[model samples]
Target: MRKIYFIALLLLCGNLYGQGLPGLGAGTTPNNKPILHGKNWVAITGKPLGATAGAAIFHQGGNAVDAACAMIAATSTMWDVLSWGGETQALIYNPHTKKVIAINALGYAPTGATVDFFKSQGMNNPPQYGPLAATTPGTPGGIMTMLAEYGTMSLEQILKPSMELAKGYPIEAQTANAIEAQKAKIKDWPYSKKIFLPHLGKEREAPEAGEIFVQEDLYQMLSKLVEAERNALKGSKSRKEAIYAAYDRFYKGDIAKEIVRGTREQGGLFTEADLANWKVKIEEPLHVNYKGIDVYKLQEWTQGPALLQSLNILENFDLKTMGYNSANYIHTLYQAMNLAFADRDFYYGDPAYVKSPMKGLLSKEYAKARAKLIGDMNDPKITAGDPYPYQGGTNPYLDILKKNQTKVASLSPGQINSTLDEQFISDFQSGTTSMETADAEGWVVSVTPSGGWIPAVVAGNTGVGLSQRMQSFVLDENLSPYNLPEPGKRPRVTLTPSLALKDGKPLLAFAVQGGDSQDQNLLQFFLNIVEFEMDVQEGTEAPNFNSYQMQSSFGDHEIRPGAIVLRKDTPEWISKELAKKGYSLEFWNKTSGPINAIWFDWKHSTFWGGSSDYGDDYGIAW
Candidate 1:
């Protein structure tokens, strides 16, 4: 009888018209749109403009990898908030290699930069400028690396769509809103204002649905890269050298000079050598096994490790048996997330500078130990666990103390001694703050590039300020016993791209875009679908919650506020249950971080794709 019921459930799900759970509606769009509705592959993104560019590449015989490159190029021009020129991180699954690779397109601090260098200069708070703030821009290098290793199309071909769009693509409401939000800051940058604003001194408005917008300078830049590639192909320059030349043209050539001048004029620190020396690092992707399937994520420099840690913690629970979205399930997941985030705050950092015990943090044994702390009965106001020690005989608690001291000196001398220092108050005031896991077959590419701090000191020839990523660091108040100033490392990042597979084959790929909310959102989305059996649309649209009790690059640290934010659509019952469990509930009209996803239907050998309706965008495909 049990077997018969299981078969019935499967049959019910297969028939769309049957009394089955909600499923995503099917659709098709031209190849110029990034939505590819093929039986073998599909791709989706947060913006129609990006999706359109990727779709064009797909139609032109480019595979998923090529489409991804084109999508990112176009996105850089359209989504200014998530700028492509900043830093890019990606996870690519190559069916041919049957292996997953992580591309760390993120920039690193210049070699000349040290914690003491700023202090010696009498700079209490180092300006987010100059060589100190600048890291090697990694987007260009990362793109080239992926194309060289896995992409089929040439650079010229992949970049063409973005180039054309840059010449002029209609600005949308979302883009307009973003620009308006930053209007005051952007006006100061002549280049940004000139390119983004309309003629007659008026700020450009998003085109009414069907209108077209264009960025001529960006188009010229893309064209220049293409021209260089063509010349290099015809000349003696190697492909690598040609690619490098193009990158130099953007960063060290006239364009770079402009940025440098602007930065220096603003008292910022970025030198030509900083740009020249920058390169994206290629590292082995971190992996974790969940429910018997291998899961892949980026390294510690990113929040990928945290995702794995959370998954490991949850592995001890049979989610299916807990019941999807039930009070019990939500509490369990929240507990696991709290524990994972604690580890993320304490240990995760740039692997090059800090020793992160990633292996132990993601171990099954560690997860079990953490999980045993959770009560199956009531949700606690706070979840606590002993600090997981780092290997090599280093205690994390001591490290935290040292980190505190170093950060205090950077902010204020007295700030280190007291948690409630005025410097802490000022630092809190200074706070400023993508998902497709798809294979290359019909690639679902999700790329998120973010600009660091505002008012970059780098000057462009056009007098535009460049990105100031150096602000990403947190100063440690504690000094090493050796008297070396502790450099506050890059906090655990929230950017993570993930792929889910079943039986060694790619089943679903998805990611989210909210700052620290990325991993939490991704985890919830997966659980909504795999364990809850909700369809793509339902899963993506479901109301979500985020916990601020753990450490974050943003928000209050000491008071784990037990806050739970809910979307407008959260069921009343769920809200009541959460409130009953001592969760401070807050509601948001909607959250940012548009999720794009693609799923494979094994029995039919067809592909399905969906872009979040939460934004003013649509998906496309051939």
Candidate 2:
């Protein structure tokens, strides 16, 4: 009965062509745009302009990877939620090779970012804003690497749309509001102020929705790469060599020098060696088999495994029998998510530095044992399970866990110390944008681009932005390999991207941009599609829930026990019932996620795409 109703609802959606979600600046665009269908290629991004740019690239003789790179570059230029100076993490699937590659393009801590360095500066945790929070940017290198290895276009061509957009593009209402919100932060940094808040003769203000906002400095920064690529192609250089030239220009050339100088002059510890030494790592994806499908994620460095662990526990139950979003379904989902997140808090970190037992954590036996801990009532405590006992492996984090579990401060020392610090205000927020692209040839790319917000200082006059990823690092001196401040360490990031394969063929690619709610958003959306059989857009539009039972990956790693918030659109009775079951309930209009995803039906030779209505997420195909 539900399946029949969903099909009928999809028919109704087919007529609401291109309509934006209510109150999200829907404009007067057509309302009949349903799940976009494509024959050869399709692209979807957090912004419509970005989707158009990427689709144009695909139509202009580029492949899926090229289109994806182009889309990321275009979105970065819009400068609302994403910045060119930010970092990205990607999950790419190549059907011809039957390979799913995970790209950890997240920025790394600078060489001087040791624990002693912060102690010497009388700091406990890393700074929340300014140059001290900055890291060696990995976005440029990540994109360049994708172009050289998998893409069929030069950096010059792929960046053309972004370069043009940077010169000037009509701003949107959402972007204008974002700029307005960051005015104070922009004013604090002269470089950010000059770029985002332009002076119109006598007065300076954020750009209006319809205004043509120009970014000459950003254009100059991007133009340097094109020039370097062109120069490298002068004689006997391959396209790959030209791409490397462009990459080196950003990481090892004048760009790197300017970043190092500006950062150092502003009391930042980043140096030329830091910039030159950083590289994007390509690793095998961390995956879990769920309901006969293989779900892959960005790896342990992020909250990716949390998604797998949650799904592992969920797979033990008959979700369809529980009914979609029913009281029982919601309860079981949160229990599984809480368990997985508990493990994430305790075990997930950069595998290079920490010994994360992947095989043990994702095992079905471990999940069953963990699921048994979820009682008939709600669990308010942040309890983590012992996967090592089931897998016959010794616990690596045992000593630190025992030492810090009880003593871990409610708030990190930095959060307490920086409370009155103007630079570290409570209202500050950083954002990220997501882009996904796929072609009929079976190539799929899910990229989450982030960083370079007004909160972080710009790297000199080069128009480059640096990441404050260091803020996610824990600053305690407990001697734990995980979550410590150390040089060359990748912070436990929340930038999780996902891919799903059915019978060894790539079928779905998706990702969203929410700091703490990323995994929860993905989990709900995944269930909507897999169990409920909802189409991409309907699943994205579905009311979502967020559980705050685990430690946050951002500033202070605050934990709020038994607190679960649901979208206001959820039934009121459900909230009341969950509250009665020892769960603290709250209502929010939007907290779970604003997700974007693409589904490929290889047997039908067609593509189906969806984007959340929360933002200006746009989906297009050709």
Candidate 3:
């Protein structure tokens, strides 16, 4: 099968130059489509089933926020990779209020969770089992928070579409692959396996293009929420009461007991108290100034600080003049990324537990100092800097510059040679997750929910697996001081949803799913639009690159590996130049991070939307 696929690719590659991939053009069937005007909306994701749910909400007179909520609920049913019982972070742009609010729906460690708890358990690090590893899920609270603050539609209206489809949506190849990959874990959870497996009591193969797939338990959960919402609207209870009732129905009622019982049977530590006491936090959004624009990000509980740091470094570069995907542009991006990552490794953590110098790190003076260290157009062998040293609330800058800068060059026209060859395996596996975006009336909503730790958590009533998450923390003795494990502290996360603005107007809504690659993908996508002025599709379809020279939750912590992977579409000359600049290139079939984006074309008065080909879906309507 591998040979057959490779041979087919080679045959296609024979005509790859000038002749693009079959579905690369506009209005491409299935992969790309144009929607009719109806408050101008489009939904794009990693699966068709998820997109259908978003589209249904738009069809139901629900605004983007309503549509986003529906889609998130639906994604849980379609892809176990993103479950409703997980953490979520969103960025909502309210045009009426002229504000972009960041929602931190990330889970927090249980009050009993701590490094010493693990130590007492004969575990050197946080255990993946029981109450110690389970953080209070914030997804439910997040959805409710958004609805109360910005939504005009009731929860019943928003949840109806997903409820109807939860029992089944047309399963596709991608959905099947996702299920099969995690079948071992799924089989352990009776409820999860019942919905995912076939009548033969085995995980089914990838479904054909239009086969129905059902998640009955999940459908029931949605139905209960809808009922609660209706009951709340009758004036018998307050809105908060209705929301909590629905939440309780899931966590403290039958479902909660099922989870607790299952975990206990499996030697896990979740308790009824943990579930009842779990509450999502409504914290302040981390704010920073990037090129005069007030950029709002999720708090450091996730990797939001790294994004701000990247923006700080980028503020000093003239990215517009560097041109799109040019060597100079890419090099500057890498340098900025390197600098941000350095701080991310050393100083980033839950601010409540660790005194992260996030404010000082994002200071303009610190950014300027870091900026001066890089030469104009030459690739440095190694980019190094301190993680924001403090002196009386300010850091001093030292003048450092290199000579012999190279001039930026235009991309040469020809067949671009891709860098993704077969020898690229370095155990650096990054997987696709789930995302949703909606705007009701003028209120915008975005959600990026991911299964960071997989294989340990099953998808259905047997409850979601969690062992993979435990492996995400760093255990280096030297870095042990920074390792995550604290009561009420959120682990460093990578599922990021972002909103971009121009001249104080919401311009772009976007996010990507790829573990540590999340922020890097975000930076590249942002630059593709804001700096290069590319259209939404161009930005989504650009040949992207990422550095493996840094440590991540998934890779070896080494610096001189020189491993870099570029998309198959990157220009050949660019690849050569990169190699000459001391990058060790590893080619791949495709290096993709599922990125979905919506661009507001103010001049045209239309919204252009796209989802990465790296995933299964991207949709739009206007």
Candidate 4:
């Protein structure tokens, strides 16, 4: 009966297209959390304290960018799956320019990090953890670059709230538990052991929950940044110049020497020259107009463009008529995302180093061709389609695609009895965190900063964790010729923050922290709001499914072609229907990652905020 009604609804949606989205059903989806509304400002992050830190910045009269910088600093300090040494990527909607700018602070493979170097170590991929996996730190330079260019506050002011937390704060259970669980790994890195394991020989080697976990070294590191800025200010440098001074100190100055010393002590490849040469990039973001809304994403260096590709393909169908989360809706989304991800696996790479053919990948004609490949049932053999023809270019790597197809054909479904399932989940949703902020002045920010998770090797006494991002690189050129790790080249990452505009104004700012699943889930969350008209909170908490049809960006970099994950409460009929379509089913308590979003209600001139209930995400508004 539901299937029949959904088909009838599809017919209605076909005609209601001219009337705009959510035209078929306007029913509100109930949410466990209320929508956070604000007329002045709204801030959301991975933790309550991080949100509070943003609020503190707003209280001090900072704009959205400033508050977001504060939250990013605070969350990194709190060890919310990242540290000061992690990478930071952001999308800032500048009210002054009326343009959304992309910030690329992603760290690249450092000195001596070559494909032959890892292969010499008998590594198919780079080491997944520890010092040798480290990349040159990017977050410090990223933070300062964003602040100096787009933010109104000084660097010292932005770091103040996080610096205070570094001095002393009652540690949360999540971080404390993470430390304890990884104590064995943490103990191997000397400086990391000194910082993470407070009671080395005790049963609980890490700090207990609710303990005042003070990171004295981290505090000192933050002070040095502040001190640099102050010294520059005293010397009559401009606010922006002073921030760059701090950035310089971390990269080219004494701090850089210490980082190289510590990394070498742990057998890592980072060098002072690598740190000296690295700089954050500010680029024009890529965008595609779906219906009337313009959605923006970072370029190929990250997996963000996959979501745009999905949106372009989805534009061909009237999703409203499919009915949200129905078997048909889920199938369509899964298929579209898989098609996009397949393209991501083959074509996406660091644009600076390769011609990614993004023009064709985002073309409507290309999306139409890709969409036609989706069959009525799950396709266990879905692979990347050529986008070059649509972009007016000849394919240069057709041989690589043939290689990938052969590789995909050689593998059967991974056995459930093996550890592959656990590894799949880990690699698919590799850890990260996010922050979102918006203010009345129209300065909007969405950041997905990650790396330096638990058990990270600390570089010197700076208390900054080295990034394990090197694992995302593949050693074989057949996997990705563009992604083969080389000194000073970035690995294609999974961190993505989303922003949308309609009629030249900010409409939404959202981001989620899950490795391969980031774009897969975010695509659904976007349709839930734009097509179904759910409020921001409802859209954020709404049940979404994941497709693992493409190769993972982490770990083994393997593909589980038919594997899919859905909410546990998904109907039995839905489950049975999917299984019949050749899907290998999996269930999780929460299908959505830790998503955070702020919707700008143009009609009411207010902001509707949302943080995922599945994780410890929180928001503040005033």
Candidate 5:
């Protein structure tokens, strides 16, 4: 009877897939939350207060860009696993241009930061914590640059919410607990201890939930930015010019001096010149057309284009015909992701410092060639594909790559120790937060700002947390030639925001907050809508799998080949079949990131928002 039941279920699923990945209509889908309906504007982010900040901006007649900046400011102030000193990368759909643009505000390695510098310190990679792990602050300049280029609001107006948050806001339990848990590390930094642990030497030094978390220095910093903009406006400068004045103040004036003082005092390598010379790049985003929809992603500095490459590979297969979460479907998606990620791990990096075969990597012909490598089962021994031939160039690193192919170990359930698994996940999927905002004027913004998470070393008395992104770079060129740390190169990071257009109009604007798992989750969330026909809410709550076969962008940059994490509620047969395919299966409570997305309901001329239930992600629409 059990055998008969399984066969009948498979046949029933086959009928469902004949229609495209299975969806049980609207009500039956696993929509943990209701879809936020907005006829004019929508704001969704990793935290509730962050969404509220954006919604307030929209309500105040701010455009999407303005609202997005406001939300970024607010979230940074709230320290939603991010701070004002962290890098900010964004994908914005400018209504005026009718084109998507990329914001590359990622910070560069400060002066004296080099692979040799780390090796000299008896380390293989940069320290995971402390001032030595810091990058030249980018969020300040990035925010100012975006405002000057695209936003209409003044710095004062845009920063009002965050300024208030800095003065004092009721801290949440999650953040408070995070501080308490890392009290030992927090105590290591005197400045961090002064602020993060108000009840010093107490049993619970970190603030309790709902405690007013105040940062006088952070509030003072906000005042400075706003004052600069206000002064520029007083001199009769244009809005853009005034914003740029504030930008100059942050990067070249008193702000930069204090930042250097605070950093160098803690044994950091930042110089005033590093901050002065750094500027955010307003880049032409990369895109690829999948089916009829055009998907845009940040350049090689991010892990975003990996999804585009994955899409190109998956597009060759009729995914709907395979059914969602089935053994074959899971295996196929995982394999394709592995291929794309393999390329990302090796090729994606700072294009300004090293050349990338992006032209060939995104080519459909290359994807077709890669798709051919996927067999009936998991290819644990998958390696990065050579795109040099496709790009009409000779491979320079062929020998080095051959010598560096990562070994895959297929382990049974008992072979996996629970302790090591926890450490592996901790290193694999670190923390970041996302902010997504859209307005009635057809402007959309998706941002994945990260680094400077809690337990961060405070830069002197500035109350500004330094970013730990330096650990993302490798010391050995053979591991990744393009990604070897240099004084001024941006590390290849996992923060990726996404925007998609259908028929040259905004279709979906999305982003998520997970270290290496970002693109993986975003890719699946996008397919859940475009391929499976699930609504935004259902897709946000949809069960997705994670492939941990690629080198993580965090910690020691470890890779766990043949390891695939799935939802705890995954079907028995699917798990059994995947295990038989040589996959080391692990069950997780939530398989994907706290994905937040906005779907433009073109037909109804309204917005549909989806915030995942996996975390504190929240959305508001009006």
Candidate 6:
């Protein structure tokens, strides 16, 4: 019956082939299109196995964190396209504490990486491929950290399904397509090619959709961690201590050594200290009060704040009055997004190195002032604002802000490599995997794990991989405060996950993986629920639009004025109207992103879940 409904929905919705593989489409899809509902819990993830693993945890009486971690492990092992060697960033809501927390699972540049190195190599930006593109492995550590700190289950317990998945899982078409698409690049690294394109007779070919894809090396790696924890348990260590033992085994023990050894040998710069010293920090999420509801985001290190800024600006208008998907709403959204993105490009960076001006950025007064700059018609030029005075407080990052100010490059063709550089940055930026879970216990988890991608050169024989995150770092020494490559400094990343609270209670948890397109897609999802009154699934599948009119978050940072790409099925009248208004309208034939979201109705004490029809998006309720 579910299969029948799924086929019907696909026929009704049309082909989402355009959502493309990992980063191209809306980030949600179903192997079976029937809406999944559960009175106890629900799981939505990038793969069927992920949803299954997460559901198993929930059935076993584990909390949301445990289920989410299990989902991460399963997806990381199976969905090589969305996340392989990727880092993780998550927004988790603890029902007990009633607090929303942000987890920064990303890694920084190795100590030896420097501006001089890229400069000497005649590269204007960090390399988008090979060892230099790789960053320290963070997925394993991040998942383990989440389980250890917030979960009720032990690592050994949560990872059983993942261990089985690692042994072998049938490759789906999307996963197969992703691997085959990168076959040339995979061949560049002997290790990656060996794992992704194992020999079936002499000629290398991508596994057929139903062929069993085995990761024996990855299986061994996971087994060792579980073994480490089991061994520790034999010594009568506490579960927490045993989890730590397993964590150390990856970051400080043999796993770390192998990662460092292979990376350095391949001319990458990771060190033993890089792995040992790295830890995922739990952070207070930055948030804004929007129509009495609080929308949470990660700090300046990610593009999360831009969504808040855009929302704040949009709050001034009655979106419903403008109508759903109306020309006015689209224009207003594009202009507001332009303002927010301009500020994001100028001000968003690692708080440790750059003062993000968060107070001013999220302040209502600042949004008002910035909103005043948006015109009814599209403006192609970049228009960043001054937030220091409007912030209502002294700028804490004054010195670094001044340094950043001096290095600003005027938007020019020379400063922006529109092709090679743009493609590279866009390709590596937010390419990611995502999962969302909600438990009857009131715990909600939204996790987007990215990094270790096809571009990465696998570190030796360790089935473990690294992320192409370092490629997100800019090479301009003059822009040191914002994007200069430095040891121990994490690149200003594009991975942003979101959680929302209404009346001081959890309302929604959602995330997507379109690099810069993430926040834009999410903004629409939020509006669809709050303003348009669409259910979570309808909102998630709604037609979406993204604009590149502002400076991009990565690479040469080009701002393409008036560039707007709408999904093909968007009303032709609306597209024509926007184009008439001097906006460059391009139709994207593929479906947009796979946005995964779970809406919590505290009043009804119920959970609603929705995902895309990309086949990769899987939702399960139990």
Judged by TM-score, which candidate is best? 5
User: What is the C-alpha lDDT profile of model 1 across 403-491, one tens digit per residue?
Assistant: 55354336532322212334333322221115353433634444555543332322443322244455444444321211112233333
Candidate 2 scores a C-alpha RMSD against the true structure in Å of 6.0
Candidate 6 lDDT tens digits, 150-253: 89888989989988887888878877877777788877777777788875354547777878888888888888899999999999998888998999998899
Q: TM-score ranking from best to worst? A: 5, 4, 2, 6, 3, 1
Q: After superposition, how far is residue 211 of candidate 1 from its true place, in Å?
A: 6.8
Q: What is the TM-score of each candidate against the true structure?
A: 0.80, 0.90, 0.81, 0.95, 0.95, 0.89
Q: Higher-lDDT candidate among 1 and 5?
A: 5
All models: lDDT?
0.60, 0.77, 0.61, 0.87, 0.87, 0.77
Give the per-residue lDDT digits (tens) of candidate 3, residues 281-342: 65566767676566667776666677777888888877766655666666777777777775
TM-score of 3: 0.81
**Per-residue alpha-carbon lDDT of candidate 4 for residues 1-622, written as tens digits (9 for 90 to 100):** 9999998675644322212245434334457877889999999999999999999999999999999999999999999999988999999999988999999999998988998899898888998889888888989988899999988999999999889998989999999999998888998999999988889788788999999998898898888999999999999999999999999999998888899999999999888899999989999999999999999999899999999999999888877777777677778888898899888887888787886989999999999998888778987777787888998888899888888777667756553221237767887788799999999999999999998999799999998998989988888878777678889888899999999999999988999988999998788888878887877887888778888878888888887767788888777877898888878888889987888999988999999999889889999998
lDDT of 5 by residue, 465-526 (tens): 88989988988777688899998899999999999999899999998888999999999899
- Stretches of candidate 1 off by over 4 Å are 1-37, 110-135, 199-214, 236-241, 251-258, 376-393, 396-446, 452-459, 462-465, 477-492, 554-560
Best candidate (score: lDDT): 4
**What's the lDDT of the predicted structure labeled candidate 6?**
0.77
Instruction: Candidate 3: list runs displaced more than 4 Å.
Output: 1-39, 116-134, 189-191, 199-211, 238-240, 375-429, 432-440, 452-456, 459-468, 480-483, 554-561
Error of 5 at 183 (Å): 1.0
Q: What is the lDDT of residue 610 in candidate 1?
A: 58
Off by over 4 Å in 2: 1-33, 120-122, 200-204, 403-430, 477-481
